[model samples]
Target: MPTILLIEDEAALGMIVKDSLEMRGFTVQYAEDGEEGLRLFRAALPDIVVADVMMPRLDGFSLAERIRAENQTVPIIFLTARSQTADVVRGFELGGNDYLKKPFSMDELIVRIKALLGRQPAAPEAPAGPLPIGRYRFDYPKQRLHLDSHAADLSNREAELLKRLYDQRNQVLERTVVLRELWGDDSFFNGRSLDVFITRLRRHVKDDPQVQIINIRGIGYKLVV
Candidate 1:
């Protein structure tokens, strides 16, 4: 049976969801606020997280961001009352795997949960890296950016981009292709956001003498091995 973490502040709704999941043979852990949810998450590391968007101490967006920083493959489902475009966009940007709007049916939630769990393959072993790139070394699965012996934590997007670049080392990755695949969008704002992330990557690898991320003018970026 899969374990699930349910983060919802409403007593009635929380109990209903928790009970429903439990009845379905899933082991469920409940948290009434974002802070406690995060604490519980770190301690237990459940198979999936179902979090409410609006909560005290910390919000769903921030919680999801934090989780993604640690485990990129963990599936997160956001429960939000607001269905605005910006809210949806932000959810995906924060690495949400699924979103459930307010007043959603319990059965629908269960179906979604099952689908997400099914999609996840067994966790892959951490790849050996910190493979010297220029002045920095990236420990891929560890998501650490290191200059010699010192290490820096990378944001989720940063880690994903770095991994992609390294995976296709020396290849020119198209800008549109990267944005659409990683970010789920290729709008002007998203394109600009990609540039910002690229700049950050450059900063991290600036110490490396051999590894360089070069912008190919009108085309894409070349991750020079």
Candidate 2:
């Protein structure tokens, strides 16, 4: 059974969600506002977070930004009524793993939670050494990419994306496959996030002309080294 930190302003809705999750054998830590959610989050970290987009003291986006600053591995799922595309994109940008619109079914939420939890990478064993990538040396353990005298720190997602590309160098890494594996789905928003990471990885290895991560059009990406 996993622990969930649920932050919602509406007391009734929060209680319903909490009760529902508890019935499914999940430990739910319910909070009426973002500030208290953050406090509980710091006190005892949960396996996953389900938070409403709007809150009284601290908004969901702000809370997610803060959480990402501390722990990048925990899964975060945002529940919101805002239907704007920009808001959805902003949620993804702020490190939300998934976004569910208001009036969403508990079954869908539970499925998403289970999918995200199942996809979480297990702790890796000690690495042999920094892996070579053209002129860059990627230290996956430390999430650092070094080139010459300069070193670029990569986020957890960035490191994972780069590692996958490097592992499949010279081959087409299917877009849908990557999306499903990394993001849990091939949704448009997750595709955009993947593009952002690709752009970042390109920037990191730009100093070396011999290494390139090229888009395969509608297919995927190919890392040429």
Candidate 3:
């Protein structure tokens, strides 16, 4: 079973989350703050880490940064309040894999966790410049897309989404398949997020009318080149 290290200061919420995750077959190590959480992280070396951003001693951003300094591939997810969009962005900037705003459902959290775990380990980097999309050049390692002389940087998740579609270019990729493979669940929220990402991607390639990520309503998406 995969081990998950959960760090949250709220006593009741902590227990509830831990119990919910355990019931879902994950081995969890609970901590009340970031200092102790970091210690446990070093000791247990869990497969994944779920932490709250407002903990005492070591905050979630710092904890995740520290963890990344030691291990780059171990997925880390942040839990924070809705207003802390800056913190959420910083958490991802610090190498966290995902984040859940406060007041989120346990089911949502579970599916996000499952989705991150389901990601295939990144493969060895390829030699040369960047992978070519219809009229754009996508540099996967750098998370950049170039159109003519202009370049747009994408978030890690966005880059991953683009890579998946590029790999299956000209194919109709099911919505659920993409959701399960990239977001862990095919829930409404994630589906909406997928829509946002799709829109962002569409804008990125809009300079070239030849490239399109078409939405096949009630079905999925098709990357047309």
Point to the candidate with the largest lDDT. 2
Q: Estimate each model's TM-score.
A: 0.57, 0.77, 0.61
lDDT at 107 for candidate 2?
Answer: 86
Report the lDDT tens digits of candidate 1 across residue range 91-159: 866767666789999877886677556432322335754666666777766668887669887754577
Model 3 lDDT tens row, 3-88: 99999999899999999999988999999999999999999999889999898999998998888788666778888874454554
Provide the global lDDT of candidate 2 against the true structure: 0.85
Q: Which pairs clash (backbone N, Cα, C closer than 3 Å) in model 1?
A: 130-138, 134-208, 134-209, 134-210, 134-211, 135-207, 135-208, 135-209
Model 2 lDDT-worst window of ten:
118-127
- Runs with alpha carbons beyond 4 Å of true place in candidate 3: 119-181, 184-225
**Per-residue C-alpha lDDT of model 2 across residues 1-225, encoded as one tens digit per residue:** 899999999999999999999999999999999999999999879999999999999999999999989887677899999968788878877777778889989988997788666545542343689989998899987789998888877765677778788878999999998887767679887787687678777878999999999999999999999
Clashes of 2: 0
Q: Cα RMSD to native, each candidate? A: 5.7, 3.6, 7.0
TM for candidate 3 is 0.61
Top TM-score prediction, candidate number: 2
Candidate rank order under lDDT: 2, 3, 1
